[model samples]
Target: MADELDWQLCRSFLAVLDEGSLSGAARALGLTQPTIGRHIEALEQALATPLFVRSPQGLVPTEAALEIRPHAEAMRAAAASLRRAISGAEGGARGTVRLTASEVVGAEVLPPMLARLRERHPGISLELVLSNRTQDLLKRESDIAIRMIRPTQSALLSRKVGVTTLGLHAHRDYLARHGTPRSLDELDGHVLIGFDKESPSIQTLRAMGFQMGREAFALRTDSDLAQLALIRAGAGIGVCQVGVARREETLVHVLPEDFVYSLDLWVVMHENLQTSERMRLVYDHLATELKAYALTSRR
Candidate 1:
């Protein structure tokens, strides 16, 4: 085994990990499947370890693969930055900047900021990946991330973007039909829509003295949008961000004003791409936009 390895092989390995299959990686890289396979085979052979275990669902990465994923991602970001630097020198700062964020933020917050970026830098392309799951930034999964929770990894650079207030809310029609409860104890008699027990949001509610066990829920979903939709459909009461709830005429706050929770939002970037112009621009724009929601009066 040699310490020296081909950069292209590492790129292919990253593409496979991101796409979850050789065929997907081949399509993404615009290379033949056999070529992609050869790269992975060479990578495994060079490292003298199997990087992934084949599964019916897809290729599941082994421990060795997981260990090297962050490094491979760093290399990819470096390569992208190098390309951008050369291109910017020739034609000014211009290229695609990819961002990953939770669905709520993507839907409620990013549009205006992204519009501003397009207006200011039309040459820069933006890719927004919306999901509840946290993307692996070290793997170059996205150039930037807007997350609800602060990232624990030391390799990434993170900034507090803003904070959002959350509280129990119910549709006007539902509350009219079932009647609103005056206190937390009365919640047991009503149908509740809530996150799963493991969700941090639910845990926070629990800590705040809200009973959020499974027994209280008539409906539940992992997706923020799904939960909001159910709430809109008059399914039951559930917790929601004030920014989102404020926009809805039918949704009304259920609890007293003092009974609210706050969550700090963060804008994060891979250390490797911290100097990239497009990424920096997007990060700055998001930080500015989120400030509006941070103030208590805004909520």
Candidate 2:
């Protein structure tokens, strides 16, 4: 069984685990669904155990799949490290760097900064993966990640650049139409915009005395970019990052002193890629630019 196992089979297995379905895994791997299915079938045959079970939602990994995941992940990480090492050896800060960030930051904050980076390092090509879900750095899903929360993975290098504050805000027109809430209690009377699903930010707000449920939001969406767009469109009052809100002149901060939360910004990369000049350059550039951006919100 050990002799039959190979990186290709392991790669497909991990992709399915990460994506939760054959189609998703195929898309992630840039392979056909039938090919991905064959890989999974071959992997299961070699191991002589079922890797997944059919469920209404999607493929659910069996205990056997979960048990072997760590070892497979370690192999994937090792391969990535080897690639990074070789690329670094042949580099002059000229290589590809994959970066991941939340949708809002990627769309709103990063464009100008990334443009500047491109101007400075013409040799460095970048791949940006914008997502609300944190990319797995250890899995090499992304070479560098700009995350709002601190990472707990020991195998990654990280830096706490700064904190970006968030506060309730609404378009000027919305406030004019429906008076601004002066206090927390008044929020219930007004149409609120927020995440449809519970998240770390929502949980933190709950812990900080903003005891509200998903039902509280009149317009609920998990996408921060979409939430900001809704607020800008005068849909409702919603949470907006200070740095982001500052750019929109029509966005009025609501109960600024009352409703405020800060998210710590982090730039992270795999520990194995520390020597990769391209990765380091991109990481440092983000750290510097993001810190400057955070300062703008405070003022």
Candidate 3:
């Protein structure tokens, strides 16, 4: 056993974990099956542990492999960030900037703005990761993030775009059939779409007096995009961004005065990224575009 370990072996291990077979890992990494096998064996030997065990389903990671997976993932993220930083240094704004945002915003709000960025700055390459789970900025999991809440991490640069205003909304057809609720109490009689799993954001809504539970919703899903789609499809009334609802003529704002909610939106990046021209260009564009979008929600 040696004090130093090879990062390449960890990469191969991750590929095998992701792809589920040595041949698949090989194809993914553009190497032969034997090379992947060797890397896994070498890594196991270096650590004096069996990383994976043979199973009917192919290869299954052993406990040891599972234990080390997060560290390896962190290494991968750091390596990618470093590569992007180096690439951006050579050319002005012609390098990759990986950005992360919530599923709804990424799917509904960001596409047009990103298209504009691509058209204006063809040299800049972008990678967008859409997830409800927050990507860690300190670990460099993403170069930039569009966050609903203000970032609390120190050593980070952030610009508050504006508050994203959410209100109860339904398709005009749904409202025509079910009849619009005149007040919050009247909501009990209408079909409602909402979250299946309660989250912090949901808790915030609950705190604001919209007490919601799984039983309360006629349709339930954790995905924000799915809820929005359901609202658009005229399934039932659901909470939606006022700005997004304004885009669709069919969607009717349910209750603006009595049932309005908002979350602070911010563009966040590592403080170190301020030195990179590419990072700044993308960050500024996101801040400006998102600010305008949030403003519309206010109206």
CA lDDT scores, all candidates in order:
0.81, 0.87, 0.91
Best by TM-score: 3
Candidate 1 lDDT over residue span 1-299, tens digit each: 44678889999999999999999999999999999999999999999999999999999999999999988878887787466445544343487777888887788667877888899889887778898778888766677888877799999999996788877889999999999999887888888886664566566556667655776678867788888888889989987888878878888988756467777888899886666676777787878777765663144
lDDT per residue for candidate 2 within 1-299, as digits (tens), equals 68778899999999999999999999999999999999999999999999999899899999999999999988887776566556556777787777889888899999999999999999887878898887788778789999888899999899998888888889999989999888989998898988888877667667667766788888988988889899999999998888899988999989988877887889899898777778888989999999999897662
lDDT of 3: 0.91
TM-score of each: 0.75, 0.81, 0.93
**Model 2: lDDT of residue 79:** 79
Better of 2 and 3 by TM-score: 3
Question: Which regions of candidate 2 are displaced past 4 Å?
Answer: 13-38, 52-85, 135-139, 151-156, 270-272
Instruction: Write the candidate numbers in order of decreasing lDDT.
Output: 3, 2, 1
Q: What is the C-alpha lDDT profile of model 3 across 1-299, one tens digit per residue?
A: 44467889989999999999999999999999999999999999899999998989999999999999999999899899888887777868789999999988898999999999999889898999999888999999999999888788888899999999999999999999989999989999999999999877787777777677899999999999999999999999998989888999999998778888888999999998888888899999999999999988894
The local lDDT score (0 to 100) that residue 66 gets in candidate 2 is 95
Q: Which candidate gets the maximum lDDT versus the true structure?
A: 3
TM-score of 1: 0.75
